[model samples]
Target: FSLYRSYFGKTSLEYHLQTLENNLTNLVKRNSELENQMAKLIQICQQVEVNTAMHEAKLVEECDELVEIIRQRKQVIAVKIKESKVMKLRKLAQQIANCRQCLERSSALITQAEQSLKENDHARFLQTARNVAERVAMATASSQVLIPDVNLNEAFDNFALDFSREKKILEGLDYLTAPNPPSIREELCTASHDTITVHWTSEDEFSVTSYELQYTIYTGQTNFISLYNSADSWMIVPNIKQNHYTVHGLQSGTRYIFFVKAINQAGSRNSEPARLKTNSQPFKLDPKTAHKKLRLSNDCLTMEKDESSLKKSHTPERFSGTGSYGAAGNVFIDSGCHYWEVLLGASTWYAIGVAYKSAPKNEWSGKNSSSWVFSRCNNNFMVRHDGKEMLVEASLQLRRLGVLLDYDNNSLSFYDAMSSQHIHTFEISFLLPVVPTFMIWNKSVMILSGLPVPDFVEGTSLDHQEQQQQQMGLCRQESPYLTGMKNCH
Candidate 1:
């Protein structure tokens, strides 16, 4: 009995010690994890603090400038008031001198009337009295009221041929001398690669007769070719009466800066030049799901419409009938975000978007819920989904366009590639990966963009890699990530 009790007690003691050791190991692991998380939280809080400081500084600067402008304007108004008061006082002193002469003239007329009465000539006496009254009338020179011989007809001589008493024509024509330039209100590139639209606010501050648009494309070297033939060097779009202008004939995938000048009677005013970059993207057409009338190039990156005959693509996934000229893109996405541009070369009608694998063929690309598209029917623009249509106004010359897809957020958007105008966006509940889609109408050609997409992910895009290489110094002896690992060890 004594041997058994000793054995049981020793066994129980060993088990308790082993359990305590295991508990200690778990607690250490948990502590390490908590420390790492705390460090990450501290870093995030520091970043937020820095960002807040930057924004606060910017707001403070703008507020100070606004307050200074108010102060200057107030000073100017006070100076003008002082000058006006001096002028009024001088005029009042001159009027007092005139009033003395009027009193002397009145006394002379009254004395003449009394002399005529003494001579017994009543008619002469009455005439002298009438003269005295006329001298004292409100119409006398010493009276407060002063009138200028200004004619309404004369004022409206060049403004209008016919003038009436009730209807006074203002100075209709703007002054020939150039006025200040119109300030830019908004500007953007269009769907067409070579076109850009600019809008400026009409300068109510200055009378603007017209405007001229000047633009320059960045041509690598210092040499630049003007759009218009002008020796002065700047190409000009003259006599733009409206506040908005759409500039045509620009190169695709190029950078351009536009300048607008408002002209009036005195001089011309120029706005601060605006700079923009055209959209760029590279994509290929998938021939496996291409429709009959759509012919894919050997490179499979471009598609053209051929109504003469059908190409022999036997894929069951292909479009048919109403959608007999559709092609899917080689790239498909299920996660992350991407942007791509397409050049629609003189195409009358076309559609661009992303479509699910099981999208219906009987309906147009945008008419099905599985597909979301920005489509053009002749000159009209429409965003269609699930047979519903939302019409939007875009120029008839839309050529280059862009698509932005966010798979994780389930959002798709389209824009004019040249001007960067937001055309449309669709919220999607993606059940499957969606492929880029192209639709052709009549005899249109869809040119896939050759520019690379903006790389947002770590390894998905070339631009992202280049950015990483620049930031991380890929050739450095010790990378920041490596140094971090070493520190952790």
Candidate 2:
């Protein structure tokens, strides 16, 4: 029994030892794997450290290169600034040198100006000093005339002439001599007329005894006649008649040249010759073939034989409006009717006769409707109902049946062949003023001295007879001289 037990115990001890050996081998294997992993981790750490160091060194090298470039650029900028400063200093020095040279030139010019002023020649000195001062002012920006003021005044005093004294001397020289010839002025009435008026002013020292007038007429044929006359000292020629001596028997259609010579006791002066052509007379109406109402008088006045005879005469009904007229003897006056009514049933055209007269000195000739001669004086205006007006002068003699007013200022003026005066003023504003005997025609109202149409009639239609009647009524009511009558022609 003791021997068997000892054997079992020995086996058990061997198994335990085997198990311990297996566990020790597993530990050794695990520790070897741990060491290999640690070695790989260490190698990775070293590579990371080396790479970090290389990157840091590269960054440092790049920073040093950038710093070096910045230093070089800063050095180049500083050098450029120093060069600009040097150039500015040089320019300032050159400008200073130019100013010094200008000052020297100006000083020399001033010296020359002073030398010119020392001489007595004032004009030359003024010219030289002006030039020098202008140049100096331009060069040095200064204004200084080098001449002394006292010296310039003295030079002017020495050279200036006494103008007032010289004028007195001239006046004294003319005191003893004979006065100048009398001044004469001559003027013609018109270009184609024979009348001549002269005006003269005699010198205070001389007296004129007699005056003479001379003239010549050309007859187109080689024949020429010269006429002369002597008269007492007078301002106007006395008894000056037309076509008497100056243009005696002159042909109607011929042009003539005439001259006037004025003579005094001292001497005579011929005036400039004037050239003129006489107007030929119009064709005359024969007495045998003339109309029935027209009768020729010895004094060239055509008289109407009978007013009632004309009313029954059966002449062709011709339309006569403003300014149209018949033969000389027939004269018509408006009876203050409207122009349209007078022109009713009539064509566009018509005619009438006009007779005008100035203020008559003789007894009023009660031949026409009324004998109150209306005068258009220089300052006064003659107004008509048919919008016509006229201006008159002294002694305007209008002949019966001599003037014809057709329209507006269109009128036949009877310029007296003997007197050369415009004898009549006619109005043709609306209708012609002519004899109503031969035919029923339009006639114009003779506007006597009164207010203008615009002043009295205020309407669009100026020729309205109603407006004219209203105006005439008002005028008659206001004026004492204007007699309201239906027969005022």
Candidate 3:
């Protein structure tokens, strides 16, 4: 058993060893297969690693692009917000400007309303009415279709006819409120040297109650003097009843401006002032009252002594002397002022003054007699009147003399016509109208000048001398060289 068991053990041992070898061989084979598989797997893992690295790099690039896009979107949103704010500011400014304009317009209307509230009720009503009228007028004028070629008055008349209702309404209101004032149409006519006829008619004849008349000397003064305020009774003309009343006792050679008014309870309307000038009468030499030796021209203004023309025929009014000849003017001054010029050319002896009719026709003129003489003889100038003698001293070499006689003042004044220098003045009261007398020696020619004398003589000038001389010096009617020559036509 031992031997069999031993041999069995040895066989078993051998079998087991064989099995171990077979198992070892198969294990080796499996280990090799596993190694090969592990190798293949390692190569595959390397390739996968490379692919994974590339994928990671791509993923990083995509992440950077996405971040940039997000940043850009945020910036756009911020810019939109800024623009919206600026638009809001602009809208707010525009709203403020609109509000300011509205405030200004409202302020002006408020001011006008306040001013209107302060006016009187009547004044406010008138202003409102006037404003409405102006507005209506403006609207009507603007509505007109202008035709430049048509007649303006005719077109306006047609236009006015359409709106005549408004005019009638206004007129009715005015008539109810007040009476209409009358208009005076006046005409003035000068009848004589001291008389004027005034004729006037009222536009509304029955509307007048009475008339008021006023006159002025046209003394270059704008103010007028009432006729009732004049000096004498002759000038005190009562307001006459008729329109054909005449104004009498006015001064001659005086310009007068007259005004008349038609009066009523409604109102007084004055007529336009009418101007009238009185007549100026000049005297001429009388041949019937001249000396026989004295000769007179055809015009009766010039008188010269002529020995050959001295015929023996004499009248009662003629002077009986041949040596000293004299002449008198035909006209006599009874009222009003008279001015005349006499040219005494280079005379050794000359006399010029006013004398009464009772004076001696053949005797020389005297101071105590009824004669006022401004005489020059042998370079001696004197004024002889009323037995009074005054030596006249002046620088003027006079060739012509101016004589002014104020009948109301009973005064006579002499002036150097060529130089306008005042010579003398005399106060006299006579019973009758005085005639202008002239006497000359050495055959001196006494010529009456046609030059108009200045109307600047002060009435009854017993005061001023230098002022009168200055006034006369500037009042030369003609040149001194024209003493012997006549006025050229």
Candidate 4:
């Protein structure tokens, strides 16, 4: 029994030892698998690190390339800026050269003009001398031909007196019966496609019984329709009423020529013709004169009733004289001495003369002869003259004349009227004062004080000697210089 028990115990011990061995082997295999898996993870981590390093290096290289590209672009922009600056400098230099050339040409023209004037003066002097010699020779011949018994001195005196009387009569006849019409005074008026206003005055002494207004319309074709002959078209305005007349109900975009004739018991004196361009829109007056009544006619002769209602409402702005403390009182006191004159001419007309009082406090003390003329006012431009009060043809009263810078190129010229010499040219850059009240008059010389003259004439004059020297230098560089004298021996 003892031997069998011991053998069973030994078998059980052997079985337990085998079970422990098997469990150890399984634990070892599991540990080996875990070690392999850790090794694989480590390898993957190393590969990832290598890849990250490569990517970082590549990114750095690309960043360096981008920086270089940016630097190159900046340099290119800088170069373009410099090139643009150089181009502008070149253009400025060209402009300077052109101005210099123009100045030289003008100088040459002035020289030529001066020479021509000198020649004309010399010719006139020679003609005067010849006429004086002829008169002396004729007088001497008449004395020599006289006989003793004929009372030669008396006869000669009588003949001379008769000749003088005949000459005076001929001159008078020429003055009275001149074929040419008197100068017409033109006033600009607002005229549109639908309506027009005509204003005129006559300087002649003839009694005007009626005024005949004539107009011609162009139909855009070869034929022009004359309104003068048409009975319905003629307007026989009595001279007892106002001088101004308005014509309305005309086609748009049409050009019309207008004229006036004064008819009386003796005869009819025809006035010079003027032109007006019509617009489709209604006529409008300048805001300054909007309150003034403007005439309108439904037919050329028949007046319209509702013309005043169509005008836009406007209030006159109060005139504020220069801020001088006593200016307002001075203007009022000198108002009587100031006189306004309107000149009408073909193609342009304006109010010209403003004579002021000499004394500020005296009723008629200040007398300053300052002229304020405007060719354009409101929308109306001076087209032609009829008599007095310029004939204006426009859509509205331009009132441009009252504007500071409203200067007519021809009207503002500073010329010696008696000598017909050009003294200066002025570009109007300031508003013109109203006639009569605005001028600071000096009666002694009949000139206005502080009136703006031409810019070139103000202050110091151009130093022609220095300018010529500078011009010579520039001309030599820019253009071929020619010697003034020829060297032919």
Model 2 segments more than 4 A misplaced = 1-26, 52-60, 86-90, 109-124, 136-489
* Every candidate's lDDT: 0.64, 0.37, 0.64, 0.39
lDDT by residue (tens digit), candidate 3, 1-489: 999999999999999999999999999999999999999999999999997798678667766785687579769966876686676666666655665655564565556556666667987767865665564455446423121122233222232114378557545542211123323334345345666676766666665667767666664455344443453421223344566567777767556676666666556666666666555456688888888777788888788877777574778777665444788888777765667787777666777888888777766564346878887766767666544445576443678788877676566788876666677766566679888888877556655532233645543375664454543343333334323422110
Evaluate residue 241 in candidate 3 and report its C-alpha lDDT on the 0 to 100 scale.
53
- The alpha-carbon deviation from the true structure for residue 67 of candidate 2, after best TM-score superposition, in angstroms, is 4.0
Q: List residue ranges in candidate 3 displaced over 4 A.
A: 1-259, 262-280, 310-312, 386-388, 443-455, 459-462, 465-489
Q: What is the Cα-based lDDT of residue 82 in candidate 4?
A: 72
Which window of 10 residues has the lowest lDDT sum in candidate 2? 447-456
lDDT of 1 at 458: 17
Q: Quick one: ranking by lDDT, best first? A: 1, 3, 4, 2
Candidate 4, residue 313: lDDT: 45
Clashing pairs in 3: 367-387, 420-472, 420-473
Which candidate gets the maximum TM-score versus the true structure? 3
State residue 51's C-alpha deviation in candidate 3, in Å: 99
What's the TM-score of every candidate structure?
0.36, 0.22, 0.47, 0.22
184: Cα error in model 1, Å? 36
The reply for model 1, stretches above 4 Å from the true place, is 1-282, 310-313, 447-489
lDDT of 4 by residue, 99-200 (tens): 566556556555644555556567775775565556445534653322112222322223211347745754553112212232234455555445777776
- Give me the displacement of residue 124 in model 2, in angstroms: 4.5
